[model samples]
Target chain A: MTLTSDRVEVAADPRQQYEQAMAERWSDGVPLLPATDDAVEAILAASPYPADHALCVLPPRNGVATVELIAINAAMAGVEPAAFGVVLAALEAMSEPEWNAFGLTTTTSSVFPMLVVNGACRDELGIDYRASCMGGAAGRGSMTIGRAVALCLRNIGGQRAGETTKSVFGQPARFGFCFGEWEERSPWPALSVRRGFRADQNVVTVHGGKGTFPLADIHNDDPRDLLYLIAKSLAFPLANPYLGNPENGEVIVAFNPMWAERFGRAFPDVEDLQRYLRAHACQPIDLWPAANAAMLADRGRVDPEGRVHLFERPDQFVPMVCGGLGSLHAIALPSFGESQMQSKAILSKS
Target chain B: MRTHGVYMRPHQSYDAGMSDPATVWVRRPTAAPGGDESAPAFRLDRAVSGLTIGVREDRAWRSWQLIGDIWSEYLRRDGAETITVETGAQVGQPGSDDRKQIDELAAVVDAAVVGLGTCGSCTTFTIKDAVALEEQERPVVAVVCEEFLVHGQNVATHLGHRDLKILVLPYPLEARPDDELRAIADEYYPRMLELLGVAS
Candidate 1:
């Protein structure tokens, strides 16, 4: 239900009252929508959820999310309803039992849900599939959709750090993080498809991730060498969520499509990259101190020979091709280690 | 190093102060009922029986361990059939093997109780395990430490669940002596019972 429809607090004309939205901290150092009633309503109209429909129930102080509430935040993020639908779908997908919102949200770990969009909608919506898609100048999908979720988290969930939230120096992505899997450009099958979605499905993959750990390497040419380096990058001492075992985590290595073609030339099959990444995402025993190493061994995180991989399955690398055709870089979106991605098809409507 | 005192300390300005009440509701001092007595509760009907309980043999961050202890304690004392899940190995930290242990534990138990376990890495996997259990249609309540309640709540809401409760426990996963533990348990257990709607 709409929870509270007690008049939306009548105000003067939104256009006249509004100035540059930059001054409000209601932004990620960017402009924002004022969340005017009209604007919010227009967005809400596009969704299948009634304005009163309860979309979610958030915690530590579980707040119920209604459609209008989501719209208000979406309006604040300057999102169109079409994109808003994607946000709704993404949020809806994350609500799945497998996404484990309860623990991810409550833990002291700096992990939050990162939305990875895939399928035909990625291109149709102009989601940046490569080259600074996660950062730098923004794409509407990356900026608005991501920002909308952050706003929803803030406005709806009431996640104020040091208050209900105990995050120590929370990461930047908490503000908003959205990027598309560059499937057409990647060397491998689309992430959504690999996860069992159809070719045409509009899918949103919800990954509980701490934040984006930039994996930029320009020196290597061969995709294998580059992937090997990328795997090593994911296996870094701090990169592994558990210092004891490499296998507890999942890392998504986002390859720009240009490199995907090349990587495919070297290893055409998607499984080849998964195998390569799995083999290479290893850390030397020296990376951990003896005591820590012992702890890892004791926990069985370390192998007998002391080899620790990021996960038992090489496919945990979660390879996806996304990004512009830029050949030199790949962004590694590290898993929060607790929340694996929960994918759901994006309904064009609500 | 301690943030609790820092957060609880009064700010530079105090416009108004209130008289101390005869009682404050929340049981754990971790949330500092003195700070703000009580919040809403995530309750259950009657009592849950036939459950296993245990936390990982891992050092947890914040109060994640508190949750595990409380969960196990709750299930144990609730007069239910309870067992604790085990990795059959010391599996903590981030790794596939740990996931396997969690998977195994989840399989072994009627349901599972996983927490962020304090560290960022383990928290992620804890979430993964909880979700996995849900896939098996097992009733799971993933505990979120005091701080992460909202984020966890938002996640739960987004996932479209009335179950998969995110239990809120205090942080600074240190031990209180047995008497204090019992006292602490005495303090909140009634409220816990009240919330869960159990006539304990």
Candidate 2:
């Protein structure tokens, strides 16, 4: 493997590489690691697929994501070669027919793939599952792997912010978002296990999250009281759940480990907790302007009691135990409402 | 040290003094297959005149509804019967209801028209419905805002319908007034008919 593409070669120094890429408008305004031959080949050697193996044709640009191409971007993002499997798995999940990558890559909405890792690889890959897991953890896997995927979307898929993509106010997560579930601390099955993957399997679940909204509560010790308020917050009038048809999309509610333990003690079963959340996740119809309320009625969203459920089914409220052991805070990754969260197991090196 | 399951290999030193630095071996990304060559084998012949046309309006956009309505009126004036359908689902977010509506519409109409593929997802859904209509052997024309003209065509090719008929209207069509939309109707109507192969 060597630097052979038509892409111009400049001084191999990091400073020169940055200048060259920036001058060509290829840099995502961030300094990129030089994708030298040794760097790209090292990443490629970790892939189970052959260098020429075709992943999927990325949308907007319709660029074919061959293994070698993905490695180049991954290398530039400073991703560890061993974690290339997770990056590939995330891209495979997005290529699923249901994920609606074609729609997501080009949407005017500020949505991006929120990668959630599960299984033993979380520890192995150093995916952040503790304090500031969504960011600020400074873990290598959490930082570089997600950035690699984002660079692929930018360079290979050509999802330039204002030029190619109509993404109005593109969120910070667009740069790359990867987090892990605190599976050991959860009462129920881990996210991947519940999604039908083996407990030991490395899996990446990609969700089209528009943005993250943090929820905090200093009081209300009772589980029901806390959950009621949280569920109500999840059903914000302007959220994607209300804006688009809610039957297809799902939301992820990340509970700090302490809160998960409290909720688990009260409900005993995860389904029960999901049901309670779904039931209370509605707002009174009067909460919306009359015109909007009428529109909700037309979609069969508002009920006779002037209430509208956040989603069509209880299972649509995905609860995952994550973040630190803090008791007062949680987070919600609101869905884009048009796509499904898809999971793909990472391929073990053969 | 391999901290997380990943570890980087040490970089090979680059000689900064070399005049012709070795070319970087980045994988060249492949473009969409069969560009411009995958035109549909079937073109509209006499299927459009006195056509029982199904007009699909994506609910997310305001312009498509007006465009469909105006087009339907002109088609009706041309001795054709038009049945208009509005999707309950948001653009690019088709559900079972949307599929059912498109299927039912395909069964009854001789041809179909779907619009407002100016944005990302909406354009995908517009092509989706248009492909469904074509699958049923009904001639279909996907109308998109000029901004998404290439995108709509690319999606069609990706869906294995290389020759799908596409009508590109000016961009920012949604914010235009009724008179402007009507003028657009008058200007593009014949071109659309020609694309549909409506016989004089």
DockQ of each: 0.07, 0.23
Model 1, span B71-102: residue lDDT tens: 56666767555544433112224334656766
Assign candidate 2 its CAPRI class.
Answer: acceptable
The candidate that achieves the highest TM-score relative to the unseen native structure: 2
Worst 10 residues of 1 chain A by lDDT: A16-25
State the lDDT at A157 in candidate 1: 63
lDDT of 1 by residue, A1-350 (tens): 23243222211334322322222223445555556556776787778777777777654444566777777778777788777778888778666655656555555568777888987777666677667777774787778888888766665665556554656667878878888876766656788889998988888888878777766767878777777787888877765455423434468777777777887898878887788887777787778888667656666666666687676777677877766666677777787665557788887652
TM-score versus the correct structure, for each prediction: 0.67, 0.87
Off by over 4 Å in 2: A1-8, B1-36, B41-49, B88-97, B100-108, B131-139, B146-191, B194-199
